[model samples]
Target: MASWQEIEREFAEFAAKVRARFDAGTNKTIATVRRDGAPRISGTELKFEGGEVTFGMMDGSMKLLDVRRDPRIAVHSPTLEPPADDPGSWPGDAKLAGAAVEVEESPDSPVPGAGYFRIDVTEVSLTYLGVPADHLVIESWDAAKGYRRRVRK
Candidate 1:
C-alpha cells in the first residue's frame, strides 16, 4: 500500500485529476463488507489532507461498525456525467481501495464524537471513456508496480 503523499509525489498530474473529481462533489460512495460478508454501500464525505484520506461517521453508525469489523474498503468518487455536447468531455471516474485504520477523533473532526478512520491505499485507479481514438483508458497506481496503463477499444 502507498500513502496519499506518495501517490501525489509519484503521479502528480494523475493524482491532481483524481483529487479534482473528489473535490467536485460533497458526497461519495464507500463499499464495506458486512459481518455476514455481504457488501454494503454508504454515502460518505472524505477529506484528503495531512497526507492521508480520512472520514468520520456518527457514533454507532452501521458503516462505522462495518469498518471496525473489517477495515477493507472501496471508495468511489462522485459520478460526473459527460457533457451533453461532448461525450468525451467527461473528466473520468476515480476509485480507491484499501484498508482503513481506526483513529482517535481530532478536535477538527466534522462530528465531535464520530468514529474516525485513516485509509491506507492499496490500489488507486481512474477510468476515462472514449479517449484517444474511441478507446477506454484505465490508469492505475499500486505500491508494488508504481504505475500502469491499460486500454480497450
Candidate 2:
C-alpha cells in the first residue's frame, strides 16, 4: 500500500490524471463489505489533504460499521458523460482500491464527530477511449509492479 504522497512522487503523470478526475465532481461511489459478506455501495465525498485520501461517514452508519469490520474498500470517481460530438474527448474515470485505515478526526474535520478513515492505496486506475476512439484504454498502477497500460477492442 502507498500513501497519496508516495503515488504523487512515484507516478506523477498518472497520479495527476487520477486526481483530476476525482476533483472534477463531488459525489463519488464507495464500496464496502457488509457483515453478511455482500457488497454495499454508498454515495460519498472524498477528501484529499496532507497528502492523504480520506473520508468521513455519518456516525453509526452502515458504511461506518462496514469499514470498522472490514477495512477493504474501493472508491470510484464522479462520472461525466462524453460530449455527443466528440466521444474521445471524455476525460475518462478513476477508481482506487485500498484498505481504509481508521484515523482520528483531524482538526479540520469536515464533519466533526464523524467516523474517519485514510486510504492506504493498493491500486489506482483510469479508463478512457483511445486516440482513435474505436477502442478502450486502461491505465493502472500498483505498489509492486508500478504501472501498466492495456487496450481492449
Candidate 3:
C-alpha cells in the first residue's frame, strides 16, 4: 500500500519521463476496444495532466468512434526501442497502462481532423523498464481487476 503523497510523487516522475520521451519525438500508441469487442490501435501524442492522461482524436475516426461507443480502453507505452548491446538490456523508463473511462467530451478536439474527448481514468499501472525488473505501482477499479505487475525476465 502506497501513501497518497508517495503515489503522487511517483506519478509526477513517471509523467516527466513520458513527457520527455514525447518531447524528444517518440509517439505512443493508444489501444481501445470497440463495442463489438475488436481491438483498435492508433498512434498519437499523449499528454499527461497531473494524474490524468488525455488523448486528442479526430471526428468520425474509427478509433474515436470506438471509444465513444465503448469507453473501456487500455493505453500502453510499449517498448518501441530494442536493447543496445544485450537483448535483455532494459531502458528503465516507466510505462503506464490501464483503463481510461471518458470523463469529458469537448466541443472541439485536437485530434487531427475534429472533436475532443476527455476521460476520467479509472485504473493505471506503472512498470519500470529494467532487469531484475520492478513494477513501481498498480492502481485500478475493484471491478476492473485493478493493477498487477509481472516481470517477464
Per-candidate Cα lDDT values, in order, are: 0.88, 0.93, 0.52
| Model 1 C-alpha lDDT per residue in residues 29-101, reported as the tens digit of each score | 9999999999999999999989889888788888989999999999999998877787788878999989989
By summed lDDT, the worst window of 10 consecutive residues in model 2 runs over 105-114
- The residue-level lDDT of candidate 1 at 100 comes to 88
Off by over 4 Å in 1: 110-113, 130-133
Model 2 residue 60 CA deviation (Å) reads 1.2
Put the candidates in lDDT order, highest first: 2, 1, 3
TM-score of each: 0.93, 0.95, 0.59
lDDT of 3 by residue, 40-138 (tens): 888866665545566676677788777767776655564446466553444333444444445445434434455354445544444444543333323
> Residue 109 CA error for candidate 2 (Å)?
3.3
The root-mean-square deviation over C-alpha atoms between each candidate and the true structure, in angstroms, is: 1.6, 1.3, 5.6
Q: Which of 2 and 3 is ahead in TM-score? A: 2
Q: Which residue runs of candidate 3 sit more than 4 Å off their true CA positions?
A: 1-25, 86-89, 92-113, 128-153
Better of 2 and 3 by lDDT: 2
Point out the worst 10-residue segment of candidate 3 by lDDT: 134-143
